[model samples]
Target chain A: MPLLKDNDFIDDTWQRLDDGAAIPATGDILVSLARLLADFGKLSNRDGRLGVEFPNEERPGVLESFLPDLSLIALTFPKFADGRAYSQARQLRQLGYDGELRAIGDVLPDQLSFMLETGFDAFEVTERFPEEAWEQAASSISLTYQSAAYQPRRLHVWRLRWARDEGV
Target chain B: MYRYDEFDHRFVSERVAQFRDQAARRLSGELTEDEFKPLRLMNGLYLQLHAYMLRVAIPYGTLSGKQMRKLADVADKYDRGYGHFTTRQNIQYNWIKLEETADLLQELSEVEMHAIQTSGNCIRNVTTDHWAGAAADELADPRPVAELLRQWSTLHPEFSFLPRKFKIAVTGAPNDRAAVKVHDIGLRMHQNDAGERGWEVIVGGGLGRTPLIGYTVREFLPETQLLSYLEAIMRVYNLHGRRDNKYKARIKILVHELGEENFRAEVEAEFARQKELDVEVESRELERISNYFAEPAFETLPRLSTGYEAARAGDPAFAQWVRSNIAAHRKDGYAIVNISLKPEGGIPGDATSEQMRTVADLAERFSVEEIRVSHHQNLVLPHVKLDDLHEVWKVLAANGLASANIGKAGDIIACPGLDYCTLATARSIPIAQTISRRFADLNRQHEIGPLRINISGCINACGHHHVAHIGILGLEKKGVEYYQITLGGSSATDASIGTILGPGFSGDKVPDAIETIVNTYLNLRQGGDDSFLDVVRRLGHQPFKEALYAPA
Candidate 1:
């Protein structure tokens, strides 16, 4: 396996799962808790994109040590009841893991823009669903909350700056 | 209210067409759920506990009577004949189906409203003082600037993917009715010694798991460069804001981590780099936006009406309502009336379809066919003639909106918690109802003075419980509902976060705890003039803490 930056078709050591597909485990492939719980620091290699899934908890853990070698991180919504993924996705972006962050598992069409804001790029298009939905979901919204992985210079922040107090 | 100009009209129509295409593709199975989640959220559609919830922007809390009527029609036709107004001056319809969202949006568009950027982590609906242009103490009308920002931030290309959702609030008055301190960016319109109106900019104030009061980043920003300076601050946040941790992703956290000096420097550097873009307000464009907000035609009516005074003296209930709900207007013979949505034991901001229609009709008949929804969850008729107030009161009394509890303790601010919102951990509205019922006596409420009781389902603080004079946060411990009480929070000019008192209580016992806190405040206060917030601020949280946790 090699870094596939050339946009050429190359196979990495990790096994690829289609959208809505159950997580597959291999000694080399990275997996998110969307299907099964896998430890981040304990993972053997960072060559593959690792999936990140959230379970309901009052407070989630911080990602201090895992940012060094993370290649691709995917967030999953087990169900709409669980919004821990929304927080996790933002935490990943804040931790400065400049990698392809994707959203997988029970991710509905309405949440694409919000997922993207917390810094998701690639979405896992499942075999159970049609591919056309992907384009529609991503383009449904034209505005965003802040300037993130995609948009870097936002103007709305200026005009709307009335007497708001953001936390320091 | 801003009617879309050619550019705005074109932009929304195109955006609608784009969404229609996306819906078509989703129907054709081209867009998958994983691929479309962000898209739907950006448009204010959320998958909730029971169904999809659609939040629609009410833009600066201003709407025409026709617009209000259309919203009523939407509620009756699409939703369950009621709509819930949120803390951000938006409305949420809880029962919207995913499939019917596009059609619903089309209906909103027909009424000159849309749910654009209402949800997504994007620039949300711009909010301002509910009293806005009509407030007696306003330095200048802030709506034109808010409208300018609304146009500039809408579908802006570079800022579409922020680390988290961002909110901005503006106010023209020194009283700070908009709670600008709790927003991602807060701007206060100020005038220098030269009488030139500019802005004092603040940033990084938000409420969630972490509650922060925004700090001033700029002492004064010239009105001309307001937009450019804002861009600079945002660009700094965009480049340096944390991306690895969700909790630490809000701009407030970044500002905190970087320190104000460093953050200010970074913004200055970025602003210096972008100076050549010439993003300042164009003279013609500024004039054009301001022209639409020019003062409404005023008749040379008497400043104080003897007729109104006579009526106020005659009707005691009307006098109480006038004292509680009426506000001074910029123009003589005109006053702003705040119609309380927190009617007795009903849901705080929920208005039934018929109530909406009736309010709309009243606005048309008495006011200038205009209504404003305050962030405090009340409707404002901004241009009512003092002489016509009694008649307006009669109409409102006939309708169910005639609650004289505008700024009173019973005028509770509540979020639709577990009963409606999927994000809520416990029920908020029911608790509010319980408290309102417990203190049902208006005489008792008036004696209590101006006390704010805000409730949130979770720490997300949508109900702004963190800043309430008496705050209640609903949390779930195991299978049961637990309520956490906080005291001394205020969102006015003197804003401060509330301090939590001891452990969480069961649902039924929560109201009793509130009663104790209020009684304690009453016992400790020096006089009637001192409000709940003032007494709490003057005397630390010791008395409140003692009263709330006194033995068994």
Candidate 2:
């Protein structure tokens, strides 16, 4: 799977581990939530940076205590139409998670803009679409009306219009 | 009445470009129908029974003369020379082609309008009272906040794919002309004891397969905190609303399942959290938006127009029109003129391109270049002078726009049904037409008094059958169409879902059944002042049910 980040395909360094797999010695690793919960003490003691594949159904607040030790959190989109992960991503970002928020599974080019706005910094993509498609999708809309996770500092249109009127 | 500024123009243009790309991709077979359905719906395009239908949003039902003319042009160029004004105060062209939709949208954009969020699971076009600024009893104008909500909900990233579609309605008056009580979220303006006007927020009220009246979540929410509060409600619903069954996915279901108290607590918690994020727009921005809706200049004139009175006395037809269609205006010299789209035996809300153009001309000449599409599927000249009413009526009558049945029995609300909608189980327009023709006599309509007969082809209640005083729902049982009747429903401040009356009737029998119900009301009422709805509510559904079900 190709990993998209910052409008380009990037090499993924994180290794996904299945349940009951032998622990890798020294590389950054991603495991499912159940694995992390079941093996929290051992996973925390590992030298590799930790990441978890959070299910969209679970609330993001459950991962609050684990945030200090985690470097990445991958949210699943079982289907593109199911939008629970967008809310989870925003909640995770609001809970002060500064890690790389990765979107995995069923991701498509058209959803890139929304995923980016909702604070997904990385996406696991299949080869169905090209890099240019993703790039175009993310940058297609030049303006947005509401504040979002990716652009918290970006002012809403009303404020921008007011500032422009005042010649600020 | 609110013109788009530079920012709004740019935003809509960009959205059009985005949709153009999406449409191109779908045409190229890069996107499947499942993926493209939602995208097209977000832009207000639907694959109806025969052809593609495009619903154009007239935000808060407000349009300028230029906008109305453009709609006429769109109908002439892209559709079958007509458009249907919907129950949501939007207009739908039923004969659209998918390939020409982008161009149609492009044309719409030039007039500061687009079909954004008119359909889809996100927040739909925010509706307000059609007589917002012109109504005599209004506390304030609700369009400013409605426009603000329009901007906020447009392409909202998190909410675009909610459990199901959401609708919001606002009203600035105690009398709920906007039908606020039946929407997913209803905002009614309220003044505190200190005369500080705020919002009374009602959540989870919706009319569909499961008709439910919303619960009041907040008695008086300060005006400035509206956006944040609504965000709270949306977030709570997005996270908790059921997705397993599309029928059970509205916020009303969540409110009902979790109980109103629990839903309110969840929303309050989320609202507090949202407040901490400081996402609410500044009060100055609201003030700026409100300035656009400020009252138009009116020339001071006497309370009575002698010319209008004389015209009324001389022409009985004109007098009847004035008595039925004209409403009191907030300004002394002006009156609100309702142009009924429901003519005798005519389709309920369909207006020809020529009619649209004539209305555009009339609006520019008489109504300060403003027009309103009412939820009752009628057009309103919100600010016509008393002296100009006669001339306006003449033009309207010439164009077949004048019908003295604004609130009368002939003014029926009907959905496209089997004629244009794929979801309809039976045809609604013909039934509505038959009923209108049955009550074609103006004297009979006036004698019957104010009544609302809403017809829906399916249980989705697109025609608002659940809220009508006399409701008709058409269903197909084993290849034959049958209609069920209900009574005493209202979409007003005193909102209630109608109770099913009795066994269904055949398509040909529905109009007679309706007449029987009306005659029963006439016989039972104590005086002329008693309305059909008042009579139904006071006497309950037994009398009407007995009349319809008794084998006579």
Candidate 3:
């Protein structure tokens, strides 16, 4: 079985990236398609963290083949209006590639919950947004339904709401 | 009123469940925003300027007192204190958050209402003559057929992904109050030589930048073949309608580019192809659907009201109201009372929450519980007795809904332009208010004859401005609001797009421009009998053009 990592495991990697001026040999590198193609063979680390970036316009089938065993899949949101990435992220999750799905550039604070709901795990959150805004945005709606791509089981909002209404 | 059968109840309940699941998926990261966008649109939720808006389809603008109350409940619970009834016979809730929508839909389902196919590239609410079974001259009530079409087209997999949205309208009245001529598919019930009731089908009529009145493709179509013929038309559109440009994607554009003869042939061919498919147009299914709209429990009463003449003579306001607001009913002594939403200086087509409750009570008590919202921004009590007219008017007036301006100039169809719609360019309600106030003199409006002044904020034509007798199009000229005037448009059986006379005028000059058009019509008309539209059709725009621009 493939190794399963949680938020804690991902946070440690991010801390290392923050501390080191350059990524260590063991550190996983999430490179976008443009950067990967530009640095084709310039940098090589046999066991290093290797991940692929998916554009909104990229076909789901192409991304599905590259997802399994990948350290991370970084999706780029070209603009807020362009909602193609939401489906792309959902498709990545549905294909059972439970590594790490990080949302990179152009993601807005308003769309954070929707992004997370669509199977995006780690967020390389924009610098413009205050840290408090991210917390509030993620927890804006306390309950949700549907089994996400990353989650092991399903959770429903109706039962919780019903129970609350019933004073349970 | 058609009560929800087991099938309808089940359908709506299942839809609610489906939407709940979709919402859950969206929340849990199973369905992304892109995947959920179409899903949300299919359920009539739209992301607007401020927040999401939910448009609830008020099929044919006919609703029971109970249904109206349910809508009022939705207003109180989920949204701001009121709902705006749209031109296409839909109610739009201006303020709706995404999370609250599923609950809202569930609540709507309890009342046998849902917003499915209200938006997206699918067949929208199949609007019919609002008077339907109640209208005096109606050969047959079109609502049953409209409901059948609604059911069949609700989530029909084949046509759901069409190039653009489709609109269908049905009318049985000779006057064409449903505006059938300006729809993708317009069905009018007609009597054949054999006295058999059928439909006069018209196709391609639409309003946008290129407004074209639909041409009669099939003069008389058998009622049984209605679904088959509609399916054929939709198939033709789906297969051949332009998908290249969003602006030119409507079936009207296809009909225009293909020409009527070729388009007719294409539809005929498709109809032939689908003729063998009995699954859709089976007589049993048609009969089953038709039975749902069986005529109401109507009691035959005396032809004349002995007290009506005395009341008319005693009350001048009653007399004036009878002259303007009351329509001829086939059943003598019973009249169709149009309750104008546009009171003097009030916003057009807006009814307060209290007014809605009062209207509901009036419907239950006076009009046999049948109420209709007209395309011209007025509500109709379709079966009020002449004896009850005064009482009905009193109840309506108490609620401030007794505006006796039914087909009058004050009953203008101004869309919720820049005031509410994000799509609007300039405000339309203010212009409508100014015109209604300018022509508030009842005698002058009656003298001007039945003139429709439809104003739209932009070229989207949601206001039906293209088909108005005097159309005002609001444009933003260097951040200043300018109004363009068009002459002699009608959406009736004799449908014609309005003609732009000359340059657009500033907001201040609009009233003068309208006055010039009306005065020119008055000058050029053969007699007082000639309407503004009639005179314009006879003389063309030259007379009105000269009158407006002559050494100004």
The local distance difference test score of model 3 is 0.75
lDDT of 1 by residue, A50-113 (tens): 5443332312234446556556665555553234555455545655667766556665544555
Rank order by TM-score, top first?
A: 2, 1, 3
DockQ of each: 0.05, 0.64, 0.02
After the best TM-score superposition of candidate 2, give how far the Cα of residue B127 lies from its true spot, in angstroms.
Answer: 0.6
- C-alpha root-mean-square deviation, each candidate: 9.6, 1.4, 10.7
Which has the higher DockQ value, candidate number 1 or candidate number 2? Answer: 2
Clashing pairs in 3: A28-A49, A117-B29, A118-B29, B205-B214
Question: For model 1, what is the error of residue B97's alpha carbon versus the real structure, in angstroms, after optimal superposition?
Answer: 1.6
The most accurate candidate by DockQ is: 2
lDDT by candidate, in order shown: 0.75, 0.90, 0.75
- The docking quality of candidate 2, as DockQ, is 0.64
Provide the TM-score for each candidate, comma-separated.
0.79, 0.98, 0.76
Of candidates 2 and 1, the better by lDDT: 2
Kindly list the per-residue Cα lDDT of model 2 for residues B1-552, writing each as its tens digit: 688888889888888998998899899999999989999999999998788889999999999999999999999999889999999999999999888999999999999999998998889999989999999999999998898888878888888889999999999999999988788999999998899999999998999999999889999999888888988899888888998999999999999999989999989987876633333445666778889988899889899999999999999999999989999999998999999999999999999999999999999999999999999999999999999999999999999999999989989999999998999999999999999999999989988889999999999999899999999999999999999998989998899999899899999999899999999999999888999999988999888878888887
State the lDDT at B352 in candidate 3.
64
Residue A16 lDDT in candidate 2: 88
Root-mean-square deviation of candidate 2: 1.4
Worst 10 residues of 3 chain B by lDDT: B275-284
Residue-by-residue lDDT tens digits, candidate 2, A1-168: 999988788899999899999888788999999999999898889788999999877878789999999999999888888788888887788788888999998998888878887888999999989888988887777777775446542346876876787899
